[model samples]
Target: MVPPLVLDIDGTMTRPDDSVDPRFFDVLPQWDAPVVIATGKSFPYPVSLCHFMHIEQNVIAENGGVVLSGEQVTTNGDGEAARRVAEEYVAAGHDIGWGQTDLTNRWRETEIAVARDQPLGPLEELAAEHGLEVVDTGFAYHVKSPRIEKGLGLKSLAPLLDRTPEEFAAVGDSENDVSTFGVAGESYAVANADAKAQRAADVVLEESYSEGTLSVLEDLRERA
Candidate 1:
């Protein structure tokens, strides 16, 4: 059988331009096993992706700070602390880069995302003061509790599906994905993946972006 899949969104399933590759809408809903959307993005983003893809809404969002499976939702991390850190970073005279009406974080429940263009030093410093950590997703900087990670999210999700983390395959492409790579039974990092992700993955695919994800799905189909 094809193993259950945990897929990262930004640099893994999206085109280089950052839009989701439309092909997934055709592929994922037909997969034999469950497909979970895992990403550093806020909850609604991945949940919506699954919704529109016509797949079951299984998601690991906010860099593992929040997880959703059917009607069950489990949240981890100290989002309030992360928000405090972001507030302090703003007080230190830096823009979180997203404006006052920042929708990027509007519905987020368990962490904060800051624009990548913003200064990382102050954010990291402030996060440390609040006992939070920052993870660079290649799309944004996530401020979350160090105790939470995508690996933990997978672990949380596994029992809900009557499987184990080691029964799942993962695909991703950034520093934020490294922890997930470490825990998955098998992990693939696309050619465009950051060095950390490539190193953590069991295989680094030659194809880049969503093309690589499609390749992974193809391989899994063949194996099944």
Candidate 2:
């Protein structure tokens, strides 16, 4: 039987511009189970990926701030709070990118995206002041609710798929993905993953990005 899988997009499947390696798709047909993408990207971003990959599974987006399956969208974080924080950052003369400054942020709900290069210490302090949370996805900094987490989001969708977290295999490469690892029966990280992500994973693949993802899928298929 094919194992269910959850994938991260930024460092795990694509480069900064969201460009995926064609070889990844060439090997996609080999897996026979649902492939759900769990990412910190805006809602539209993951939706496009699902469409491109021809995946019918639900996608967890905005760092578990939202879950989209078909036409239904379930949101767990506070979009209003996210927006407020973004405005506050700008008023304080912080150079951050969001809906007001970056069109991509307009499609995002539940979290505001800030450039990764921006100082996070101030953001964390700012979030704490407002009873919010800050998370780094290697690609950007997300300001969201403290309760939102990828593992919880993935587990919430299990009933829809008729499977549990223990039945899924997850692969990711960032601090934001650590929660995802906690719930998957099989978890893996690319060689380029940070030490925290690598430690949280059950296995660390030899390759990076989509190559590591392909390796994980092949190994899981063999074991199955």
Tens-digit lDDT track of model 1 for 79-173? 78878887888888898888879999998888888999999988998888888888888888988888899999999998898888888999999
What does candidate 2 score on TM?
0.93
What are the lDDT figures for the candidates, one per model?
0.90, 0.83
In candidate 1, list every pair of residues with a backbone clash: none
**Model 1 global lDDT (CA atoms, 0 to 1):** 0.90
lDDT of each residue in 102-177, candidate 2, tens digit only: 9658788788889887778888888888889888777788888878988988888876788889989999999889
For all predicted structures, in order, the TM-scores are: 0.97, 0.93
lDDT (C-alpha) at residue 38 in model 2: 94
Worst 10 residues of 1 by lDDT: 77-86
